[model samples]
Target: MRHRKAGNKLGRNHSHRRALLRNLVTSVVIEDRVETTVAKAKAVRPLVEKMITLGKRGDIHSRRQAAAFLQTPESVSRLFATVAPRYGDRQGGYLRIVRTGFRQGDGGEKAMIELLGAEQELGAKQQKRAEAKAKKREELERQLAEQGGNEEGGSEENA
Candidate 1:
């Protein structure tokens, strides 16, 4: 019987499957990348590419259609304002899925689905995070040093 069927059901009914795909598409648009199981990454790739195509159209009608399908208005806006423009000269193949090995719990294969040409943005974000972490570490060390100094001074006074 299962002759002409396409697209995996992902073990959910129609509504839940639609919702899950919408949320995944929204996350990919907003964050430029998402780490998920291979099956989900494969399932979401086409929808993300379709949204990017709509964004490239740059019309109100296309925007409305994308907004209706995507999970959030912010995703729609990002898709139009930032994500779409990056592919102005490109044709298709907007997304890429890279295998990242298997998950620990269920042994499902893991993959990272990301928009092409997003590496620079992701790198900048990573740099900012590293800088923030370094700053926090320094602050914590200063606080510990101050506490140690205070404790030594207090002990001396007690003596």
Candidate 2:
């Protein structure tokens, strides 16, 4: 029979599936990324994208709508204030999915779902930290070189 159905049931009823998707969407919004089953990631991608699209409006109705769907004021605020603004210039395709092998227990496929702009921010922070470390290392090397030169000159004078 299973002819007209397009989406996976995931062994859950209608309400349960909706709830699961909502929770997953909320987590993704709050954390900007999450490791989840590949099927779940594919299922929730459009929902998260639509929520971000709603957030782009930045209005009362849109906020309320997103809040209603996400069920948390904090997540809603973050989506509007932080997540959405980053994607304001871009069109669709707000989420990225990367396959990360399989779960060891049941051997289910695992994947990482992440918002596009969030990675850039993380990378920038890492880059800044790396740059700072590199500068400190260079300074230490210069100081050591100068000390070695001074020691050589002092020893020459003694000789």
Candidate 3:
């Protein structure tokens, strides 16, 4: 029986695995959303959270640590300036993973990992805008129908 293994190996050596995790974490911080295999997404979630936790500290050591892991100055800056602020009052759970079903090429399980608060707020705003647009379209159609009916009545009276 398998016992005491902490993480998914993804069939890579230690250095490669570390590099892969750092890249994944960096991309997640930069894009704020990523589509990836479910296993990798799950594995990278905690690493990204730790980076955000460090960013939240907003200290010199944390910045250096983040820079070392991220390997990009811009990404580190974004992590501290944009990402960390969003999670200010919250304690943990900085991400949300949604299963996106199977991938076509290899049939691997796919998922979308997104920073939680921003996506949810954006979704709400989009939904509201969509609803308003639909309502406006319906009102226009009603007015058009009313005008059409009036035109028809006038035509009949003229005939």
TM-score to true structure, per model? 0.96, 0.74, 0.73
Best by lDDT: 1
What does candidate 1's lDDT look like per residue over 1-159, in tens digits? 789989999999999999999999999999998999898999998899999999999999999999899978888899999999999999999999999999999899999999999999999999999999999999999999999999999999999
lDDT of 2: 0.93
The clash numbers for all candidates, in the given order, read 0, 0, 0
Better of 1 and 2 by lDDT: 1
Give the least accurate 10-residue stretch of model 1, judged by summed lDDT.
70-79
Candidate 3 lDDT tens digits, 74-158 = 9999999989999899999999999999999989999999898777755776899999999999999999999999999999999
By TM-score, rank the candidates, best first: 1, 2, 3
List candidate 1 segments past 4 Å from native.
none
Which pairs clash (backbone N, Cα, C closer than 3 Å) in model 3? none
| 10 residues in a row with least lDDT, candidate 3 | 117-126
Give lDDT per model, in order: 0.95, 0.93, 0.92
Candidate 1 TM-score, C-alpha based: 0.96
